[model samples]
Target: MLVDLHSHTIFSDGRSTHAEMVEAAIAKGIGIYGIADHLCFHDNPWTTRLDQFEEMRSTFANLKANTTSAKILFGMEVDYVRGCENRVLRLKEENHWDYIIGSVHYIGDWNIDSNAADWEGKDVDATYTKYLELLEEMVDTKLYNIVAHLDLPKKYGHFTDIDFTDRYRAIGEKILANNMAFEMNTAGRIKICNEFYPRRDIVELYHQLGVDVTLGSDAHHRNNVGQFFDEAVALLKEVGYSRICYFEEGQKRYLPL
Candidate 1:
């Protein structure tokens, strides 16, 4: 069963409408497909506006009722900002989403993945450390079901000389403690990094830590729905993961890979 829990539509930065993305997912044989568009408190070009929630909820309701080929989920990739907990919580409460994916794309107003210029002559190690620290804090909030793109700092192919094995393990521990899962986002393969999010070694460490995982394409275009899913499943199996997880009515569920 192919369960892709992360995708986008015109609601965010995606290139297609919700209907188009769902049709593509059906064609791709996705068993359970989720459309998790970007949801951030801060105003941004790629995030869905707070005012559009009601319309999106209604649209999802209609899609769930009409779509029969695959199980369509109403999800949101919510950004984890330090002072935006209440806003996120309120959104979750009002929407009653099937799942909420928490992600950290900004570090003190610096959009880490925006461009390589953000890393100019700065302390790469400190930035990496800060990202992990924020990741841990996001998990600690216990407000999210899955963490999107575990190692986002590598999106621009940036690497830190300092070893972060312990840090990765610590994040895994926190996810386990909070009963949250991290997604093996495949979008990274097309990014400058040319690798999957949460590198192979990190996946192996998570497996060792007994942390759960889910699959996400992070697709912004209709054609990319369930993109690279076969490779992702193969990698998970190689890392000793026999099953992958998803959520239903805000409850976590699993399916064999």
Candidate 2:
């Protein structure tokens, strides 16, 4: 069964509405699909607007009520910002989300993943170090169920010079310690990264660590709901993953490969 729980809508940086995405997922034969729009600090360029956030909530309710062919879950992809744990916790309570995908999109106001060309003066090593630090903290807080796009900074060919294997190992350990799922994000297949998030070697490490795995297209468009999933599954199988996970109402379920 194809179960995907990481995607966005027009409410955030995505291109399709919830209805269009549902149609796409159904066509792809997905067993369970979720709409996980960005619910980050209001300052980010891709964050959902206040009014759109409310509208999407209603859309989620309607979709959940109406969807019968496939399970529809309401999820949030939140950006972890230091010193904003209270806000994040409050938002979690307010949303009553089915699952939350925690990600680090910013490091001290330097939006590393926002653009690659703009990274002229940024210290590549220092930047990723800070990201991993925040990731460790996020895991410790137990504020999210899945870690979105692990090692996303490698996207856009920006980390070619940096070797963050140790950092990634630490991040993997934290995810395992905190009982969070490691997301296998297929969006990287289309991004300049030219591979999945966490890379194959890192994924193998996670498999060795016995971390629970989850897959996400990170699709922003309707047509992208389950894109690149076959390749992702093949990679997972090669890495020795026998089961994959999906979440519903914050509960994790494992599906055999």
Candidate 3:
């Protein structure tokens, strides 16, 4: 049974509605599906608001109540912006979400998108350093169940000139210390990079550090649901990960890949 823990819907930047995403998951034979829409952040114009969150939550609950074939877990893909702990805490307190995935989509003042050429001639190492710093801060919040996609800057080719192994190892140690699972987001294969987020080497390092892993498609559309999931499982297996993590009632459990 395969479980995809990261996905989005029309409530945020995704192209499809929540029901459509769930139906697509069913078609893929997924045993579990998590609806993680983008969390509201100060810089991003596309962030979800409180009312939208409640609406999405109610919609998901209603959908889950009517279904029995596939388990649907409600979640949010929170942006790891500076000083985002207060918002996270409030959301967790008010909602009964099954999981929360903290992700870093921006570094300092720069946003990561499909445009890699825009970052030309910039200091790659400094940018990564700032990003890692934010990652460490986010992990310290202890508000997220999983870290969405480590080394996401690679998506924009920012990490090409930087050796992020040692730095990532340090970050991995912190993530392990916090007992938070790192996600292997398969959406990258279809993104500008045409590769998995964090790449394989970073995943291997996380495994070496004894950190647990979760798999996500980071799907923004129905067709993108569970994209490249089989390959993600194969990668995890190659890295010695026997199972993938799932969250329920603010706790995590492992499921076989």
Candidate 4:
């Protein structure tokens, strides 16, 4: 059975409604489907509002109650921006979400969705360094169940010249120290990079560091629900990973891969 832990719905920037996303997962025979809409500061356009959260929660509850074959889990993909601890804590305290995926979608003064031409040419090493700094902060805050797409700056195409081994080792150490699971996100294959997020080298390094791993599609549409999931499982098995992590009531649990 396959489990996809990172997905979005119309509550954020995704194209599909929550029910459509869930139904598609069921059709694909996915064992567990987690809905993780974007969560960011109120000023961000993609930030999921409280009403949207309630609507998604209602949808998940109904699906869980009515569906016997598949399990639908409610989660959020929160951007780890500066000064986000209180919001993270509040969301966890107030909601009965199954998991939270913390990601660094913005740097010191740059956002991932920016279209400025020069942004693409920025130094890959420096950008990754800054991203790692933010990742360390995310781990220190202890506000999430998993770290989504550990090496996201590679999506910008500037990291082709950079060697990520040492850097990934450092980041993997921090993740292990915090007992946080690192996600092998397949969304990159369909999105900007046309490759798996974090790539293979990073995944092997994480395995070497003894860091637990999780698989996520980061799916924004119904067709992409389980994109590259079988390949992801194969890669995990190759790296000696026997299980993937899941979240229940804010705690992490291992499930057979």
On TM-score, the leading prediction is 1
lDDT per residue (tens digit) for residues 77-122 in model 1: 9999997889888889999899999999999888888778878876
1-257, model 4: which lDDT tens digit per residue?
A: 88888888888888998888888888888888888899877466677887766777778789878877778888888888779799789887777888889889888657754454647557766878788889878877877888998878767555656665786787788878877788889988865667898888788888888999887888889999988888999999998899988777777788887
lDDT of candidate 2 at residue 102, scale 0 to 100? 93
Error of 2 at 242 (Å): 1.0
C-alpha RMSD by candidate, in order: 1.0, 1.5, 1.6, 1.8
Question: What are the lDDT scores of the predictions, listed in order?
Answer: 0.91, 0.86, 0.83, 0.82
Look at candidate 3 and tell me the lDDT of residue 109: 64
lDDT tens digits, residue span 153-229, model 3: 76754555767688788778887887788898998887666789778989999999999898899999999999998
lDDT, residue 113, candidate 1: 85
**Model 3 CA lDDT for position 48:** 79
Query: What is the Cα root-mean-square deviation between model 2 and the actual structure?
Result: 1.5
Candidate 3: count the clashes. Answer: 0
Q: What TM-score would candidate 3 get against the native?
A: 0.94
TM-scores, all models, native as reference: 0.97, 0.95, 0.94, 0.92
Clash pairs (backbone) in predicted model 3: none
Better of 3 and 4 by TM-score: 3
Worst 10 residues of 2 by lDDT: 48-57
Locate the minimum summed-lDDT window of 10 residues in model 4: 112-121
Clashes of each: 0, 0, 0, 0
Q: Looking at candidate 2, what is the lDDT of residue 42?
A: 44
